[model samples]
Target chain A: AQSVSQHNHHVILSEAASLELGCNYSYGGTVNLFWYVQYPGQHLQLLLKYFSGDPLVKGIKGFEAEFIKSKFSFNLRKPSVQWSDTAEYFCAVRGSASYDKVIFGPGTSLSVIP
Target chain B: EAGVAQSPRYKIIEKRQSVAFWCNPISGHATLYWYQQILGQGPKLLIQFQNNGVVDDSQLPKDRFSAERLKGVDSTLKIQPAKLEDSAVYLCASSPAGVRAGELFFGEGSRLTVL
Candidate 1:
């Protein structure tokens, strides 16, 4: 059974603070990883994705995630957070051979304070 | 280009009732998907359709859930005799054809509250 786990349920940070959201998956085969964000009253939007090539991927709004194969993790990070960064983030994975279906992690909620 | 479109942004139904959600994918998209997102959780894939064919329905609860994509453009997801646990947001998404890593465009979603 494949599953994605988001360790942090909720995180609160002041403006300009660094942000890191942990994500781990239990799959040995090749996988496609994605990070999605949902702001208040908005639909889910793709932040970034990791297919092949590089392990470090940058996305919109100054977000980035590094895929660590050894650790089975693709943790999202931001150097400096802003109040507008408050939203819910999700990590997802799909098999490399075919994008038949995607499995998503529970989700992590971030609240940025000014 | 317009993103995926879903109707009835919100719905409130009693348990054991029936409900349906409609989705219109972006023009020329060949892949469509339905997902259910419970409060405070990530969206869960319920079904996937490639054109007019069903590619995957492994996660869908067939006993109470059914979906169809007639003509391969628009889709409908229905829940019969809905249960309290069915209270969630139903999202519809679509992607372009022949791309291995195509990004999915999601709709606003239809929120269902089963009282």
Candidate 2:
């Protein structure tokens, strides 16, 4: 079974501060990685995903993640964050070969001070 | 296009009572999923459906929980004799088939409060 681990449970940051959330998965074979975000009183939405091609992938809202196969990590990064970025982020992973189930991490709550 | 639709945005029930949540996936989507999201935790897959057949229900507590997608369009999840631990947000998601099959589009979720 595949499992995802997020290093930080909660993160506090000021406006314009750079942010990075650590995410690692325990899967040996080829896998698909995704970052999902849920704002206050909203449904979960996809932030970005990495299936193949370049290691780095960009998604909506200037968010990006890099799939480091060697490290088994796909940490999310943003050079600057705004107050609207305050939300809960979840990291998910699934094997690419078959219809494998996607496993999610505990999630990281980000609170950006305005 | 409209996103996934879920009904009974909030539900409250006493212990040992029953509750059911409905979900309508996006049009043309070939897969539907039901996930349970406890407070402060990420969503956990309770069941997955590819069309009308079940793809996975390994994490579902089958003894108390039951779900079905009869027409391969809308789905219903029912829990009989609910427990306190069953209190969570039931999220419905769907994805297209083929290359984009894994990317999920989620619903607003149905929140359940077991007292």
Candidate 3:
């Protein structure tokens, strides 16, 4: 089974502050990476995804993630975050050989100060 | 388009009791998945189905948990003699089969509590 690790379990940042969430995967193979977010009382929504093409993938809400194969890392970052960005972020992966079996990291909780 | 829909937004049951959760996937999605999300933890894939056939159930506790997606549309997951450890939110998701980069659309999830 492939395991994913998020360096920060909880993060606190003020409005307009730069944000970065670290994600690392254990599997070394053809994999698809993704970041999902869940706001309070809402279902999980897609933040961004990295398939093949470029390592840097931009997603909704001015967020992006860079896929670093050499480091086995796909870190999510944003230049400035808003209070709306306060939510639970999850990093997920699916190996091509696994028949699309998706695996998710524990998740990182982000709280944005007003 | 309508997203995945789940019933019984919340449920509470005693240990050794039986409970069931239902899911209705997107109108035309070919793949459906069941996941368990414990508090402060990520969602764990419990089972996956391709249409009406079972694709994966390796992580499911066969002795107590059973799921079936009959008629290739709606699915139901049942846990008999549920344990305390089974207390968690159950999420139902769906995706287009063979779509390598497609994201799984998730439901609001059914929260469960067992005493």
Candidate 4:
């Protein structure tokens, strides 16, 4: 079975602090990676996705993620984060063999203090 | 374009009761999805539909849970003899067909409280 793992369960940071959330998946085949964000009381939306790209994918809101295929990792990064960025982040993966199912990680909650 | 719409935004039912939720996906979207999101956890895929056909339903609890997408436009999910562990937010999402791993537009979700 394919699975996703997010290292950070919860994080607290001050405004303008840099952010990097680690995500790793357990799959040995072609895969599609994605990061989704859910704001308080809001539905989940896509942040970014990587299929066959330059490894570095830029997304909306100054967010970017690097897909390191060898490491089986796709880490989301932002040079600086604002209080508005506080939300829950989920890493998802869809294996080529089973494109119908997208497995999601446990999620990481980020709290930005203003 | 209108985003996915879900009905019965909130539902509370005792264990062993039955409940149903409805969803209307975006116009022209052939792929629809249902996910269960427990508090403090990420959304878990329960089923996926392509057009009027079932594309995937591996995680759905067949014994007590059932879903159908009629006419490939609207969908309904029902839970019979609901269990306490079934308390969660049921999310409906949709995407265009043939877009592999495409972005999913989600609805506000139907929150269920199985007491």
Give all TM-scores, in the order shown.
0.97, 0.98, 0.97, 0.96
Best by TM-score: 2
Query: What are the runs in model 4 whose C-alpha is more than 4 Å off?
Result: A97-99
Residue B104, candidate 2: C-alpha displacement in angstroms: 0.6
lDDT of 2 by residue, B85-114 (tens): 999999999988777768899999999999
TM-score of candidate 3 to 2 decimals: 0.97
Model 1 docking tier (incorrect/acceptable/medium/high)? medium
Candidate with best lDDT: 2
Tens-place lDDT per residue, model 4, A14-101, is 9999999999999868888999999998988899999785999999999999999889999999999999999999999986543456
Better candidate number, 2 or 3, judged by DockQ: 2
* Model 4 chain B: ten consecutive residues of lowest lDDT: B95-104
Q: Residue B24: error of model 1 in Å? A: 0.4
Scored against the true structure, residue B11 in model 4 reaches a CA lDDT of 99
CA displacement after TM-score superposition, residue A71 of candidate 2 (Å) = 0.7
lDDT, residue A89, candidate 1: 95
List candidate 1 segments past 4 Å from native: B100-102
lDDT tens digits by residue: candidate 3, A14-103: 999999999999886889999999999999989989888899999999999999999999999999999999999999998875356889
TM-score of 4: 0.96
Grade the docking of candidate 3: medium
DockQ of each: 0.66, 0.75, 0.64, 0.62
lDDT digits (tens) for residues B1-112 of candidate 3 = 9999999999999999999999999988888999999999999999999889888898999999999999999999999999999999999999875544347899999999
